[model samples]
Target: MDSKLNRSVIDISICSRSISDQNSSETGKESHEKKFLDKNFTTKRHLKSRHIQLIAIGGSIGTGLFVTIATGLIKGGAAGLLIATVFWTCVMLLLTSAVGEMVVQYPAPSPFVEMAGRCIDEAVECAAGWNFFLMEALYIPFEITAVSSIIDFWRDDYSAAIPISIIIALYTAINVFNVKYFGESEFWLSIGKLILCVGLLFFTLITMCGGNPAHDAFGFRYFKIDPFGSGYVTTGGLGKFEGWLGALFQANFFVVGPEYISMIANEAHYPVRKNLSTCFKTVIWRLCLFYIGGALSVGILIAYNNPTLVAANTAGESSAAASPYVIAMENLNIKVLPDIVNAIILLSALSAGNSYFFCSSRQLYSLSKRGFAPAFFQICTSSGVPIFCILVVIAFACLSFMELGTGGSLTALTYITSICTKSQMLNYLYMGVTYIAFYHACKAQGIDKSTYAYRSWFQPYSAYIVTFFLLVLCGVQGYTVFLPGWWSVEDFIFYYIMIFVNVAIYIFWKVIKRTPFRKSSEVDLVSGLKEIEEYEYEHFKIAEEAQINSDTDSEDYKKKNAKEIFNNVKTWIF
Candidate 1:
């Protein structure tokens, strides 16, 4: 529902062959137009700039930040958690820049997946498509399980099956019925997420400064007392290093990057490509301020060794009182606000679940359109909903029932976090590789970077830097499983399985298809360019006409324009 490769894994050398013939072949129809934009074949473009931007921000801000930040605080302490947030935020910035450039030029269905094939290799495309598909598909259950666990904030125990069944039905109804419902619903939910984020951050700041009933002024108290944690199954510098690693992996769960935006770019049809660029540009700061600032605020609000948090972690509870923020609020005797926060956080979970449900189905649809998945998945309703893809994801939604077993939701949350986080980072890694290929291809083919629909800062350099760190992070996150007394077959599988599977898919496609790497000069930059340009202009005109008709009722044009500007700015910041 939310967020490929056609490049050779090896043979990094640039090809000397000219791709001047590429345009002649770029007549662009391997029937991709029919396969993708044929509304009968794929979904419609109803997501506006606000819808795309909010879906991404809301998706990234859910249980990972609100429900599970305590895990980071428990395992990595204040210092480790804060460092991880900052580090991942930077990675998000760099990765978004890399991917944003690609999306600007190619706004196809599953934009990056398509670009990978054209610029890199079809083999890379297939592997990327499936990895991405799995990444989003698996997240649907993880979020639903989280929704159930968040319910533990109120009830100690209930049949997780009840909520799971209800949510699955709702997901089917929304995704199978009309995409406008998806976009509009996500838009409002995202608005709620925005309000909740602002409120929580303010709550943290105020309570930390002795603004609560207790007037404790616990500013940086935890940071001073327990800056770093002694990590799992180890000690000394190694333990601290492992603590940081745990924090990094945990942080990765929250800071979803530009790829979420890329997933909905074709749908945004927001009428202005520049605003899409704005969406990409602003996302980094939004994440930085919300996530990094939240981690820092958590550190200032409470100590890592708080009794409530320790007990909850020991019991594997993902309830409201289990959250470090809620614990801090409880200690201050500020009882009602924690409940409010929890309620919003629950809505936050529902919103996130819906967005992921939407994204996973779309991603599967994208794969089907590209022929990486079965053809039946390519069939969409007249309303532009991919019924089969939605059904496929729903079929897997039953995995949420696994939350009923053993450690319950918290256990499942941890395992799924490892898989989904690394899978997301791997997608980022694929993007970096894809962008590098794209960058070189642009140079080789005499296409100036400046001429791109949008330009990201520190281009090829950002790509190179992101590539190094992501590779290191991806390989190292599973280090704990190998340590003495820490081996978990299940955790190991969740943590590292995506990496192996991603590699296997790439290799399998490369071998079975015998797909050769595209020469840098031979990349299909021209295919679909005209269609994208026309679509953008058409969307703009339609939106402009709508704006004019709406404005016709205003008694005074200047005052109305001022009010509109004030509302937009107010909404943007607060």
Candidate 2:
């Protein structure tokens, strides 16, 4: 056994001769002696900032923006929009900052999940991973149902089964290919959605100003009729307030993908810190243009209380051709343009479904790699894609088609999507807590400040604010479930069932495995300390050059030389 091990090491050295020569050339030192290496690990960095940025944009622009916000608009009137926008802005600030700080530190695959394990506790990691997996998986059916409804706009009498099948098949094909291909497809789809949104914004502005190119301007006559009346424009209780809250939540839901960018940290090139920072910066404009623009356009042109808008909201058919955008376009007499917009909605939904597939599969893949899931799911194809995990995702997505076949299709679809949102809210709250712990862990360890790429300002305060608001939203959602005669107790039961299921899973796994909670210091410090050595070694030449330029005396040079000498010695030892 010892001989075999020695032979393996010798062969690996022969194969990595180039790396050894390069290291020796830079330091002008003999490096024939081989260092120990981890036999089970591999580094594969393939993502670019463009991919990260577009993925962020794609995360924010989806069927929820084009359709679901109508429910909120119908409920809260304009105030709902104000509340949602404010809530979302605050949540994003906390999430973006928390996630941004973590990614810069460790820069790994499935960042949030790993951080949850290392920073908070292993059980928290399990909760977060499964929550993300279940939430994203739940969206598959909602997206399919939504696309099927959108397709029915033109067919009138068409059955949803045909469209649902076609959408499932297309989405599966895209995800099964490869990550780069998946990204390329997402980029183009994002472009199409961006163009469509920009066009809608400009067209709505023109119509409101009474410049119909062929008719008298509608002006703001509709606004004066009743700014908060019965439908999309109302400002009452469940009628207006609920409607706007619905829209606000739906808009925020569409933009949830920005955090998923953290999952790709291991695949990103360049300085992981700088690239992660660049990736997060992409969220600001995406929210501004997609969510804000889409909501405002719906509010201004379509009477807030339009009959069709009310019907869709009450029926939860925001997925249908009766969406706020469609209602507004049809009111303008734009010929076949409403149908065109409906087609765009279907395309966008399909895009979102593709993303859900990718995220869910990758989440499972990450879990498997960490021993939390079955080893079979860790298998990656030659392209570095997790083929087995992707197949499992597609299988679950196909199950979502049941919504189209059921009598309660609309409600079922909305419930499933709502569950997805609820699960994510739970994950966000956990992330906030984990981030706070991670910051303090560094301080306790006396880790050098300069080594950290980015620091989350406001510390525990920012995290606390985010966690508090999330709990409030959860409370609001729960309250709505039992609003006297306004809501059914069954709604509350179903919503809480999903949360209970996640907790149940965590508790069951903990007891069955008899796993004890590891202290923060005992936690695997992948980003906290282990990588510091790797980074210094990788950038040794640069550090050497920097030190040489900092001082001119031979003694200072000797001191710098001693530092590098010690680093090299430490690298060779433990």
Best of the candidates, TM-score? 1
- Identify the leading candidate in terms of lDDT: 1
- Reference-based lDDT, each prediction: 0.78, 0.67
Global local distance difference test of model 1: 0.78
> Candidate 2: global Cα-lDDT?
0.67
Residue-wise C-alpha lDDT for candidate 1, range 1-574, written one tens digit per residue:
1100212211121121124335534776465444532434556778766666777787777867875787788778899999988988888888888888888777777888888898899998998888888888888887787777777777856687888898888877777777778877777777887887888888888877778887788777789875878664577877777777778788887777876788777776655466578788777688788898888887788787888888987776666767777887778788688878888787788888887777788888888778788888888876788887888888778778777777566476557645877788788888889999999999999987776667987878989999899988888877878877879889789888888998899898898889989999999899877566656655565677877777565777668778878867754863
Model 2 lDDT per residue over 1-574, tens place: 9857755655565547658867766785333223222222233455555666666566556787778767656655544564576568657766777777787677766787788878766777787788888888877877877777676676748666777788778877777665777777776776667777777888878888876645757665655544444543233454555555565566556556345677667666554567677666555545666566666666677676788787767765645466776777666666777777777777788777777877788888888877788987777754567777878887777766676555676456556666777787777777777777776776667666555566665776888887787777765655555555557655776557667877887887777776666565665655433343344334454567786677666787778779868854532221
Work out candidate 2's RMSD over C-alphas. 10.6
lDDT of 2 at 574: 12
For model 2 the local lDDT of residue 189 reads 78
Q: After superposition, how far is residue 249 of candidate 1 from its true place, in Å?
A: 1.4
For candidate 1, give the lDDT of residue 417. Answer: 48
